[model samples]
Target chain A: MSRLAAKFEELAQSGRKALIPFITAGDPSPGFTVPMMHAMVKAGVDVIELGVPFSDPMADGPVIQRASERALAHKMSLRRTLEIAAEFRKTDQTTPVVLMGYLNPIEAMTYEGFANAAQRADIDGVLTVDLPPEEGQECSALLKARGIDPIFLLAPNSSVDRVKKMDAVGSGYLYYVSLKGVTGAGHLDVADVENKLQQIRANTQLPVAIGFGVKDAETANTIAHLGDGVVIGSALISKIETNLDNPEQAKNEIVELLTSIRQALDCGLGTEGVQE
Target chain B: MTEKYNMPDERGHFGPYGGIFVAETLIPPIQELNAAYQKYLKDPEFIAELDADLKYYVGRPSPLYHAERWSRELGGAQIYLKREDLNHTGSHKINNTVGQALLAKRMGKTRIIAETGAGQHGVATATVAARLGLECVVYMGAVDVARQSLNVYRMKLLGAKVVAVESGSKTLKDALNEALRDWVTNVDNTFYIIGTVAGPHPYPAMVRDFQAIIGREAKQQCLEATGRLPDALVACVGGGSNAIGLFYPFIEDESVKMYGVEAAGDGVATGRHSAPLCAGRPGVLHGNRTYLMADDDGEIIETHSISAGLDYPGVGPEHAWLKDTGRATYVNITDTEALEGFYALTHMEGIIPALESSHAMAYALKLAPTMGKDETLIINLSGRGDKDMQTMAKREGIEL
Candidate 1:
């Protein structure tokens, strides 16, 4: 089984929700990404979603967009991001690292080339922000052939028919965008998310990870109870953006944030002993 | 040849060029738009309403005039100008905006949003929004909002809120990003009217169908005026709406040659031009698989053009398909050549063409002299030059 499937199975047996912390690769600089990945794992993150910076991030809000701009300024490319994942794998091998970004760079590298490079780099999965299941068949096939899980997003507006289509082709987990807006925008109404999750659960057995507008431990912990995993992105990147001149402080801040969320998930859910 | 040029086979692939390469959150909205478009496109009532608005509101059947003086000076082919510049609002952009705004209304949308580069499309969109009394917002790059203040004010005067996007290489592409964000956020009540023949499925094809009226009218006019189809067709391409608008009706007419003029800022060899089909490679950007000006590592490069409308780093997917199929030829026109065409027409025909359209005019000037005078070349004069006066003045070292 892939690292993602194994980790989810472990989390389920332990009665604990997974904590997935997202940070853009090479956000402050190329050297900081690997260290940040390690820090996330130490803070009890079950999975890491590393953002592959692009010049234009249409689906992101101001916070993550700034993260991408900073990464791109540091000359971050898909190949360099893969190298970062390879570096992160030097000491940590069990955590699944999912590279997420728009499709242009992958198209530039070609699907087969990207899949080969990603596999060689120890990357576990890929969630291309712009490529839905309809447009992702060939790329998904290539990634699956290479033992890389193809992740997809499920939005609040996704109809039952669309969810069924994604459930058929999608692997790893279904990233449920918990709100109606882009990342980092909109107020998360837990009730609205719960309602949507109920609809989504009726259709597929794939693990559903809820993300978008997850700013605090309270929201994250509340969301943890409602889904298989809680994915926090813009909130963590905002910490990096605030401490760009101090990489050590940025890493510490993210670690502290994720650790607190991990605590909240454990305490709030009254689950088994914390991973740490 | 088959009488039909059927393409974008159900999956939105224009021979592997156009597809829905947008984020997952966007699929449902795009699918809704596609369904609505499929429904209303074949409905006779919708067609009649659209045709009536095209004629009565937009003042269609814009004349195809033989530029007698300009042709004599060019000294070769008798060149005819399809006066899209004379269309209401002084450009062909209104054709697509009006069509989309009407569709938005039919879809029960109360608000309309759009993105603009040179501000032509924003103004066109704002005009229709005011006509329909729908709330409108337009996203423009901060750099463009500054360069084209007059258009910014024009949009405001038309009661549309204008948002200045200050992002990476703040220009057309950034504005496009902002518009897409707005659409994803407000997908329920808002309808995004993309200004180009790019974006995911339904957009490239839908915008092409709406703007195709230009070629449809020009084809009939050319036959009526010259007693046969013109031997050649030329139009300037940015995101390639105007060019495709004029070329789509003629794609099946093998006797008519098509030329798409791209802005070669200095030259294609200079690596500064916006001629994606001529110089760049295929990549996905702004929701479609098309030719783009991206660097080796896949970073989108900033494009240079004297015309803000043609400064985009990508072209429409149909143009890419057309180029690959050898159905149409693509060429480039430098800023220097376009300026000469701009001045030549102003002096000879008393008609000033937009800098975007001047690229087509420039290519026509070079090709007209090489062809027989009996042959006819119809150029789609896409817009008027009033918006370019400041750029022209600055180019001549004068403060406007």
Candidate 2:
């Protein structure tokens, strides 16, 4: 099995909901990333989504968009992002790292080239936001062939048919965008998410990681009872954006937030353990 | 050749160019939109209402006037103007906006949003929203807002809330990014009227179909006047709507050579131009895989053009397909040459053309002298030059 599948399975065996923290690969500077990855893992992240910043992050809200701008300012490319993942893997190999972003850079690099580079970099999975399964078949097959799980997103509006389509093409886990809006949008209807999760579960046995609206530890705990994993992106990137003048301070803020969310998830999962 | 020139296939692939390359959250909204578009496209009542609006409101069948003097001066091909500049809102943009806004109404969407470059599409979209009493928001790059303040004010007068996006490069592509972000957030009740023949599946094909009225009418008008189809067609391609609008109908007419002109701002050799089909490579941007002005690192380079509309890094995906399949010839016009075309048309024809359209005029200026005078060329005068007065005046050392 791929590292992503193994990580999810290990988390399920431990009766804990996975905490997937996403940070753009070279946000602020290239030097700030590998250390940040270590910090997030130390704070109890089960999976790491290292964002590959694209110039036009169309699906992202203002916060993550700013993060991309910052990353690009530091000359972060997909190749550099993979190098960062490789650097992260030097110290830590057990934690599954998913490279997340748009598909253009990968397209520029060519799918086969990207898959080969990603596999060499010890990257576990990829979640290209703009590549739905319709255009994802060839790239997904390439990634899956290289033992890198091809992750896909399942939205609130996704039909059972769409869910099955995702499940058929996607491996590792299906990312369920828990809101009707872009990443960093803060409108969460737990009841709506729960209803969607029921449909998603009925269609796909692949682990579903819910993202887009999980902000606080309480929300994370609530989500822990509802899904296989919780993804916190803009909330964490907001720390880096807020502390652009101080990278260490931003790192500390990220650690502080993730530590609390980790505690809440561990505590909640111990008591309830994903009430599915 | 609506039957013969069926390029996008059913799934919106103009060969391997256009496809739905958006995030998962957008799939359902676009699918819902596609369903409504498909339903209304086949509905005769919808077609009747659209026709009535086009005829009465937009003043359709914009005349094809022969530029006899200009053609005589060029001393080669007799050139004709399709005169899309005479259309309502001063461009062919209204054709698509009016159609989309009507579809949005049928879909029960209360809000209409759009992105604009030279602000023609913004004004066009705003005009429809005002007519329909729908809430309208227009995203323009901060650079475009500053440059095209006249159209910004026009949009505001049409009751659109103009948002100046201060993002990467601050141009049409940035405005599109902000608009896509807005659409993703407000997909529930909002109708995003993309300004051009780009953006995912239904948009390229749907916008092409709406704008195809330009070609459909021009073809008949050319035949009626000249006793045969024109030998050549030329249009400026900024996200390629105007060009596609003119070229799509002529695809099956193999003898009618088509030219899609792109802005070569400093010249394509300088790498400071927006001629993607001329200089750039294929990559995905703004929900479609198309020819883009991206660097080796896949970062969209800042595009330069005297015309704000043509200052986009990517062209419409179908243009890429057309270029690849050898159905159309794509060329570039420099800012200096385009300015010369702008002045030449103003002097020779007494008709000032939009700077965006000036690119096509520039290409025509070159090609018209080379072809036989008996052969005719129809230049899609896509918009009026009123919006470009400030830039032109500035170039002439006049403050106003």
**TM-scores for all predictions:** 0.99, 0.98
Clashing pairs in 2: none
Q: Indicate which candidate wins on TM-score.
A: 1
TM-score of chain A of 1: 0.98
Q: After superposition, how far is residue B242 of candidate 1 from its true place, in Å?
A: 0.7
Instruction: Provide the lDDT at B340 for model 1.
Output: 85
RMSD, each candidate, Å? 1.1, 2.0
Query: What is the C-alpha lDDT profile of model 1 across B152-271, one tens digit per residue?
Result: 999999999999999988899999999999999999999999989999999999999999999999999988988999999999999999999999999999999999999999889999
Count of backbone clashes, every candidate in sequence: 0, 0
In DockQ, how does model 1 score against the reference complex?
A: 0.85
Candidate 1 clashing pairs, residues 3+ apart or interchain: none
